[model samples]
Target: MKREVRIMNYFPGCDPTEIRMSGNYRYYLSKKGERPLIVIGMNPSLANRKRADLTVRKISKVAMLSGFDGWVMLNVHPIYSTNPKAVKPTVNNKKQLRKNLNFIREHLNKFPDAPVFVAWGKNDGVYILDTGRKMVNDLLKEMGRECYAFKLNKDNTPAHPSRLPYKIMIDAATNMNCIYKLQGS
Candidate 1:
């Protein structure tokens, strides 16, 4: 029997619009042969209105084309709040973070051995590290699977702007068989 892969999609904060503008909205991982579980962020950005329709259309296409199991929207609850001073508010809230992890656990209970957990980050790069760390722990505890977080470079290579930190993350993930694949613009 073929193993079913499920993706839990994660986006920073509560912005439906940001979710739409993200590269994953256009180039879905399922198209690359990986299963995706979409977890959308709650924060809305200025460009959301412009990209909302297109993003929805693309997501719809991916859903039809890839047959996603389902999606969970994080940062949507009223109680979820973030620190403005922090670069990424999503990581700052421990309560919401646990909720997100629970969401992942619920999904993993149904589908086993999925390769990746797709998450979208803010342009500022604030949420990536926290999100990556949480994902790693969540995956290990729930499924014994390792997780990786990759940020794409301008050339679409798996490179981080901060080379040293990126290298450290890559090495760590690699050692655990988790890799963040960077895509170029």
Candidate 2:
């Protein structure tokens, strides 16, 4: 399949890059700069190199306001889906999950000093994303890196950027603290 590529005008003259595999799974989306904010979400939506989804746009705003020149968006799951609840993984998806984790690890290593923002949110009380969140946290811990969020749900899950109130999100962007405390630590 021919790859589709386009430059996003989100940063205006700043080159943006995107990586997708087999035409559907997006591994990364980044607006290039010296200092990039790392954001980890639950999964990819319709956002692409050609367009910015609401979440991506919101992240860009928060990142810029928070003193970062650019942002990189990653997901626990790489499959593209607008409704995250609809992404039910099968046995075959386990391989994809491993690949996603490895990609996250490698990319994160490249930005050792960049702050990581977790915004996967509570999976609508279904708890479908608990395992993924734990896996991510484990990886971060093993790597000796920590992540923060604008807000965490009552249950302690990081609040999804798309669902957060603008004022709260903006205020917390530069003043975030670690929200997911490791168990028995």
Candidate 3:
């Protein structure tokens, strides 16, 4: 299949080099400097637009209350699809996943101590996500960094920020010291 590559635009007024495009399947960042919160979603959703999407809004709000100066959004697969099961069909490919990992790795290297959020949400199939999760876990382990989750869902995965109540989200974010659960590597 022919791949459609896309670029991730950063929030307004931020530097444009936080991320860059490669291999037509990689995601780019827009924020210029250090971000306190770094989020990892499953993959690109068709719903994404020039403006922040629902998930982004939720994350931004949480970041603000967490006393974070800024945030960067990333994905596990870096593929765009509305179907929640989209990742299952393409988990093993190296082209996109490798590039995506490289992009994410650069940011993690840049922000050595920023909090990492795994917010892929519960999907019909998590095979791809699980793989991504393990990769993230291993990376964090290797770097001696930590990962976090909101732990509000039945499956024990991080709640998609959209499903979380604004008040509860803000409340949790403010208690950064106690809110997030450690994600095992």
Top lDDT prediction, candidate number? 2
Candidates 1 and 3 compared: the better one by TM-score is 3
Q: Can you give the TM-score per candidate against the true fold? A: 0.37, 0.83, 0.74
TM-score of 2: 0.83
lDDT of 2 by residue, 1-185 (tens): 43342324454533356555546677778887678888999887867776777777778777777788878888877778776666665664556777788889987888888888888877764233455556777888888776788788888878889888767777776776555554331
> How many pairs of residues collide in model 2?
0
- TM-score, prediction 1: 0.37
Report the C-alpha displacement of residue 147, candidate 2, in angstroms: 1.2
Q: lDDT per model, in order? A: 0.34, 0.73, 0.62
Model 1 residue runs over 4 Å out of place are 1-57, 67-92, 113-117, 122-142, 146-185
How well is each residue in 43-137 modelled by candidate 1, as lDDT tens digits?
Answer: 22112322232222333233333344333222221121232123344443434445545554654554455434233343344453345334534
Top model number, TM-score:
2
- As a TM-score, model 3 comes out at 0.74
Distance from true location, Cα of 145 in model 2, Å? 1.2
Q: In what order do the candidates fall by lDDT, top score first?
A: 2, 3, 1
